[model samples]
Structure formats: C-alpha cells, structure tokens
Target: MEAVLYAQERSKETRATLNSLRENGNIPAILYGKNVSNVPISVEKLDFKKQFNEIGKNGIFTIDVDGKRQQAIVRNYEVDPITREIIHIDFLAVNSLSVITADVRIVLVNDAEGVKDGGVLQQSMFDLSVTTNVNRFPDAIEVDVTHLQVGETITVGKIRQQYPFEINHENDEVIASILPPRQEEEISTGEEQEPGIPENLEGREE
Candidate 1:
C-alpha cells in the first residue's frame, strides 16, 4: 500500500530545535538516497504514525516536502527508550525500478496440527530480510503452518520456493517448528512434576 505524508523542510537541526519540533508534535526526519541529497524535514507525529500503520516498513510511499513530492520508503527510525516514542526517522528516496533491502514481518497462518494435539508451537524467526524490486516489495510474508506436525519445522528454503523475492538467509534457517508436548514426570514422592520444555520456552520473544 502507498501513502502520502506531508512534511516541511527543516532549516535548523540543533538539539534544541529538534526538541522543540517534538514538543510541537512533529518528528524530525531526513530524506536521502542514491542521487538525492539529504533533506532534513519534519512531519506531524500523528500523521506519520497513521501513514506508517497503513503502509508497513517495506511498503513504498510518497513524501511531500513542501510542494515537492518524492517516492520513498522508511529505511529506519529511532525511538526513545523511556517513552517508546519515535524520535527520528530515515526516509530513503526511491523510484519504481529501485531494488531495496528490507525486513518483512513473518506471519503464521492457521493453527498448526501439532498445536491441536497439545504440542507446543514455536516461532523462531519473526521477520526475514529480503532484497526485491521496490514495486514488488511485500509488507509481510505469511507461512502456512496448518499441516505442521510435532517435530516438524518450516525452513527458509521452503519459504523461498513459494516466493520469488530473494531472501537474505540460509536455506536451512528454521522459521517455525512444533515441539513435542510437555511430559509429566512422577517424582519419588509420587507427585507429578512438570518436565520437558518450560511453558515459556527460552529464546522466544513476545
């Protein structure tokens, strides 16, 4: 999806100036790419968040700087660790034929068969790095896990076979997997104790 964001050229980039812009509900950003010179600008915080929600990080959009419009994509952003508020943004100008590298979110579709059988479903990778034409970029990649069974896994190679884009990962990289169900162990005292993997598996991020 494509969106248009309105911004105004920023004349001052001092710390105080940037803080002032943020205080005024604007985010300071820079737009640059290839042959384009870096242009410092500011956009309304609410407007940027709205458009960003519509078009994900990989989605191409247009940035209207004053009266000039340029096709661009969100390259990166900085957020305040304390407030979790976006502080700065980096916009990369691009054309239709431009090839870009981006991280596309991985979405698991449907309930896995193993999960239905009391097995634990674990997603190892939440996103994937890909290089593709700007026009062919995807917001997210959906992996069907409906048929995944216990001890079975979906790998990067399997995903690559379904998508035409170039994935910047090894073919053997595991995306998602189903582990055997938790087993209960009988202690010497004849009490049932939880065993096997913990309910909250290690290395799994929320």
Candidate 2:
C-alpha cells in the first residue's frame, strides 16, 4: 500500500493552472497535514490514474513533496462531468501506522445461481466503509455470489471477515440481492422499440 509518488511545488494560485495541468496530463492538487501546512503540488496525471485505479480513492499514499515524504490519503477528486477527465484532487495527511476509516469497493464474484435461473442480481451497496489501521486496510471487499438464491439478500453482516477491520455500515443493509429478471426480451422483440430505454441498467454494462 505504500508507494512513492513525486510532485512539483506550485504557487501561482490561479485556477488557470488547473486547466494547464490537465492539458499536460498532470493533476492539480494540494497537500495538507495536521503537522504541516497546506502546500500546492502537482502530480503526473498518468501516474495518478494508474495508482487510483489500483488502490482506489481512499488508500494510503506516500507523496514526496519537495524531497520531504508525507503519508496521506486521497480526500477528494473532481472529474469532468461530460468527458470524465480528472480535474482537482485533495490529499489529507495521516500517520502510516494510525487507524483510519475508509470506504472500500465491493466486488461480487462468480455468477450467482439465482441469476442463471432467470433472476436479476441487484448490488445495493457498491462499497463498504470501515475503520482499521492504515497498514491493515484491504484493497477491496469480496462478496461471493455463488450461493445466493432468488429473493435472497446478502447483508453487510454476512460478509466473511478476511481482514481485521470494523465494518461501519448497517448490518441489515442489503449489499446484494437476487430478484426476478425482466422477461421483456420476448415482448420487446415483437413490439416496436420504445423511447428512453437505456442501454445499461444501474450503471452496469451487462
């Protein structure tokens, strides 16, 4: 989880730098620490894109700011609405050994038996935030979908603990469910195409 990141010192304070950085494939960011004051910094967009994709938005990061290393985590990120281009980023300083809470992405594994039986799989929660030491945090939560049956609900409490962390979400919150799949394929083929039928449902490509 601890990886070295390099950044440049910037102080122009103009929002135009943000645009300029984007054009150069760099991220406009600020580094702030409880022990250190806020400092303007810029990082290569390509480097950040790779790290973010692998570690996610909340994982621990070791940033080298002006040759001084600091332990931090991503606090916020802004992306273009239409183009989905990253714009702004914020980093919060933290001790590498300190305990912190972060939301980890949930990955559904295997094809559910219920879905194979003409049932729809609903992922209610995409991520589960937890409290744990920085060194002990997990990259993601794995929820097995193989045993789920139609109309069966998987709650946060049902997850097998593979890591030593405290789950902060409600135990009763359904993370995934098996519902009856839509039987509209037969009807749609026979009828004219309707307006406003999206290509994907719930942001899934299917």
Best by lDDT: 1
Per-model tally of clashing residue pairs: 0, 0
What are the Cα lDDT values of the candidates?
0.92, 0.84
lDDT tens readout by residue for model 2, 136-171 = 777788889998999899998787365578999777
* Candidate 2 residue pairs that clash: none
Candidate 1 lDDT, 1-206, residue by residue in tens: 45989999998878999999999999999999999999999999999998888877777778998889999988999999999999999999999889988888999999999999999999999999999999998878999999999999999998797998999999999999999999988658666667876766867888
Q: Tell me model 2's lDDT, rounded to 2 decimals.
A: 0.84
Please give the distance, in angstroms, between residue 83's alpha carbon in candidate 1 and its true position after superposition.
1.5
Give the residue spans of candidate 2 off by over 4 A.
Answer: 16-18, 160-163, 180-206
Query: Each prediction's TM-score against the native?
Result: 0.87, 0.76
Of candidate 2, the 10-residue stretch with the lowest lDDT total is 184-193
Question: Could you report the Cα RMSD, in angstroms, for every candidate shown?
Answer: 11.7, 12.4
The parts of candidate 1 lying over 4 Å away from their true place are: 188-206
Deviation (Å) of 106 in candidate 1? 0.9
